[model samples]
Target: MSYLDPAIAVIDPVAAAGPYGREGTAIGFRVICVLTQEYRTPYVTQTFDPADFSEVYQHSCIDETVAFLKSRSVVAVVPGAPPSLKIVDVLAESLGLIGNPTESLEARRNKRVMKEYWTRHEVPCAAFHESGDLESVISWADGRGYPVVLKPNASVGGVHVFVCANRQEVVDAFNVIVSRADPYHQQFSTVLAEEYLDGDEYFMDLAHTGGGEAMPVAFAKYEKIQRNGNASIYKNMFSLPLDDPIALAALPYVRSVNDALGVRYGINDTEFKMTSRGPRVVEVNNRLPGASVPLMIQRCSGLNVFQENIRIFVDGRRTSGDYHFERHYNICCLINDQPGVVQGYAGLDEVRELLSYDGERMIAPQGVHWPVTRDLDGCWGLIRLVHEDREQLSRDAEAVHAMMRLLVA
Candidate 1:
């Protein structure tokens, strides 16, 4: 499924540009880097820098973007983040490129809208209410019961999400959620409060064709670092065996949620809570799975989520062949709770010896004062580990946690 010269327009690949270029190389497509900043990366074949009019969705900027696309016949447009997705949707629709509708992107990016859509379509989800009024949210939570999850209407990486067990906590958490919204997107201020479903959490990464079909690449079970049994400050995700019964059982619900969202042409990261009633949708994001998931999935299984999305859009199909699911149980740990300046890392040589990792990945740059993590985005660093046996995995996780110290000032 290698393309000879299929030019793909990618919008704002994050981390100063690496993923998009790697994706292009993986699929043999020439990536046209369309960015918001004057960032440079070695992976892209060509680059285009337009005016900052799109920060306000300016008409002139859109015209320039269209003009640039016309200069090269792009086979598809791939957006990295939610904001970038909105921009690409507008540009793709204008240029007749493959992408989601603007309205769908808008709705999907907002939690309130996505929940309403799921509710209308009879999708299995938690009871939720939204308002700028904290009193109303408190009332709704009171009726629902002890715990409720408050989150910003529009966000990424679990930003401004709080689990409140009481009315006062709800008020404090709601204010935090509201204040965390992006200033430009006013609708984001409308916070959402949902009846928190306490259960085991899991996530699935997959690619969809927008044709009512989804191909699951990898599945994971999460272990949350909870504070006072309410707020999840950190997340430890372990890649479940692909053929595990729990993983198999969640596929139908995943497909239903994907179809309900009208997902067509992109990678999706869907997180859910497996309650006593059944699996309930926590959130469905139309984007690539973050952190070390893409690499972990490739290590555990032959299927590459990023490349699969490209193949889905360009070739109108997924990677052909059975996945060689390695028996390795991979764990991705996000150290969010530890806060301070990173003086140095202890047991670097020992941890590196015990764990399998790419040499380039580290906790974070040292000496910068680190703040207390309030959400998933504020996580300090990612530590990836893998093992073949469950007992060995548990033993390795403990050893790594104890030895891989983030020495803070």
Candidate 2:
């Protein structure tokens, strides 16, 4: 598309280079990238190219940026990452474009505010408290009993999230979260503590084309193994059929969550725990699912979230029909259990030889010193598996974990 064509403003296009950058071009719209150093990541700094964008503007001042975006023929404003969630709302409201309500920005981005909104709307959510004082957090957790969860009020990729089994653990977890800045480089003044729900965690991807309704697009159950006191170290995530029993049960609750958060436009990625009580929400993100999840969904189900989102915003198309899987898909996270300098990856050839092996993203290259894989961000890389047979896909996914080893010295 020509630069003169109508454009979409994508703020902090971190992991969305493929989606809003390249795929947006394929769908016939110029992409205007509003860059930010505040949300820097390896994906943004090392992988993204400025050439992919039609016009790049540094977001040092919001007024200047909004003024510039207003000068262009921008039709819609969308967030490319979590840090840009609030900013996207601001821009969209300022530009008079289709987007989420700026009035409920906190309900979409802050964990504490989100839960409060859900509770007010009578949506089932975990019990929680937010405070900067350790005594206040510990007191709340004590009343709730042992094994509470502690995390930043507005952080992504499971940064500093810990499942504390006792008061000591809570203290330790609290110190860690408050001691460092979040992935977005913002210091945490308050930590959110919530009662830990005991059950399997599942990821549900939804889209709100327009109106008050949000459609369910895809669902995946996360296989998380607790290690080193962290409760949500992702092992693998496999796609579930639309008609799956769990998917059926969780659909209504997730849709309610979408509505509660005021996510009337763009994609929503919500994580829910299938607790003994029922399906309870873990967290809600008003952006595309991270870790190339949309790509995997497209590969297996032929539903390109990126393309569909552009179609909805740019072409004014409403989504219809249900999503179905054409192939079994699994995303296996490559982990380094111990921290050290990387030597090389072992048994990768064997992993590639598997019938279900589709592709891999090796984030930690050889000779790079890396920390132990405690959360999604610390993972060595990710290996994607796809096959016609679900059994073969499962076997290959397990084999990937066993065969592929991150050799850290």
TM-score of each: 0.86, 0.96
Which 10 consecutive positions of candidate 1 have the poorest summed lDDT?
Answer: 40-49
State in Å the error of residue 367, model 1: 1.7
lDDT for model 1, on a 0 to 1 scale? 0.67
lDDT of candidate 1 over 136-240, digit per residue (tens): 898899998978888777666566677887888888887776664431233356678888887898998767766645767778888776564335555567778
Q: What is residue 122's positional error in candidate 1, in angstroms?
A: 0.8
Tell how far residue 234 is off in model 1, in angstroms: 3.0
- Considering summed lDDT, which 10 consecutive residues are worst modelled in model 2? 38-47
TM-score of 2: 0.96
Query: What local distance difference test score does each model get?
Result: 0.67, 0.83
